[model samples]
Target: MPIDHKQTYDGNNIFARIVRGEIPSKKVLETEHSLAFHDINPLAAIHVLVIPKGPYVSWEDFSANASDAEIADFVRAVGETARIVGAEPQGYRLLANTGKRAGQEVAHLHVHIFGGQPLGGMLAR
Candidate 1:
């Protein structure tokens, strides 16, 4: 289920906790503005979640509030994480679900990197 993009950032969300060093995650890469970690429940062989270190509820929020440096760092972090996870050679899908219909379970903005095998159609038929 997706969450309200306008909702205030939850400091206790799993990603937030992970960023704050309260929850443990299989970290892939950590930069000043972003953190990339393997998803606990992966849908693909190389599923990872790249999230900004700042408190943001959704992509819109992040885009509207995050600094230019933060945004640039986050973007680079996603690409770096994908390369580090060996997904570049095989191609990968970058997904950032926003709004209620997109199935964004977590309130925090995260870009999912899915790859390592044929992903088939972009959406189920």
Candidate 2:
């Protein structure tokens, strides 16, 4: 189900469970403020999801509530995850779906790194 950006953060969400070690994920990178892992249902050849450690429902919630250090660390973690996945060489796309309209399936703030081949257009026509 798509998440509502205005809704409160759900601690029991999938990403939260993964963070708590209750759910297993093929981890790609782990930082003080973020966690990167391979997406189980990958959209591309190289698809990864980077999520903040904090309880943020969306990017707006994260930007408004997270500490500066946490924000920086999360951003760096995403970049480092891309580099570690070897997606930086071919360039990549970072996507964060904020609401149901945008197809945000998780109630946690996560950035999807998509690459490893020609991605074509920004959106399907």
Candidate 3:
């Protein structure tokens, strides 16, 4: 446990609260290691967040030590989330902001699934 997992998220971390059942979410899909739900602040017609259940601060942290099973679970959750957002048979953008510089406001590791229309190019400066 190199990083302080407890400090990774405070009580205000909405995803953490959702996972803990402290708050209700439009849960679209889930697995032993991952959970998917609609984004409260949606950027597109269909925007969802796919998050891992482990104590992870960001994508870099999760990818660095995620087991094969954990990685598979995350990816499967992403796929399921895409389907839930109607991004499957069509397409979508998957976003995982790694750090502050990348616009990751939440410490909990999550992948954003957004689509249902012509999305913007990318994160602009």
Candidate 4:
């Protein structure tokens, strides 16, 4: 686990504010429980991040308190975004970096959905 496991950062804590027009973002999709936006620095042709509208700094924070319904809603939103982004049939990669060692930079819990091209090689890099 990350050293900052005890710390909790809600969507409204920062980034979500940007998405909600409280700040600003290169936004994409928004739902009641989740939000999607293009990665500021993308690693793939279609790199969008799907994040829950909750106060969870990382997956640990979310998993510890989030309900099954919250989890389901997040997945469903990702699936819907995938279809909308044309990564449905071809599929995509959903990446959740749990900690700094795992390459989670932003601190907020988010799943990166990317594909529409070769992904296997990208993972090894």
lDDT of each: 0.94, 0.95, 0.81, 0.78
Q: What ranges in model 3 sit over 4 Å off?
A: 1-12
lDDT of 3 by residue, 63-105 (tens): 8878889889999889977876689776899998776556677
- Candidate 2 residue pairs in clash (backbone atoms < 3 Å): none
| Cα TM-score of candidate 3 | 0.86
* Cα shift from native, residue 91, model 1 (Å): 0.4
Taking every candidate in turn, the Cα RMSD to the unseen true structure, in Å, is: 0.8, 0.7, 4.0, 2.8
- TM-score against native, each model: 0.97, 0.97, 0.86, 0.82
Per-residue lDDT of model 1, residues 10-119, tens digit only: 89999999999999999999999999999999999999999999998889999999999999999999999999999999899999998788888899999999999999
- Which 10-residue span in candidate 2 carries the lowest summed lDDT? 1-10
- What is the TM-score ranking, best to worst? 2, 1, 3, 4
Which runs in model 2 stand beyond 4 Å of their true positions?
A: none
Ranking the candidates on lDDT from highest down gives 2, 1, 3, 4
Give lDDT tens digits, candidate 4, residues 35-98.
8888788988989888887777788888878888888888888988888888878879998887
Q: How many steric clashes between backbone atoms does each model show?
A: 0, 0, 0, 1
On residues 20-42, what C-alpha lDDT tens digit does candidate 2 reach at each position?
Answer: 99999999999888999999999
Deviation of model 2 at 75, angstroms: 0.5
RMSD from true fold, candidate 4: 2.8
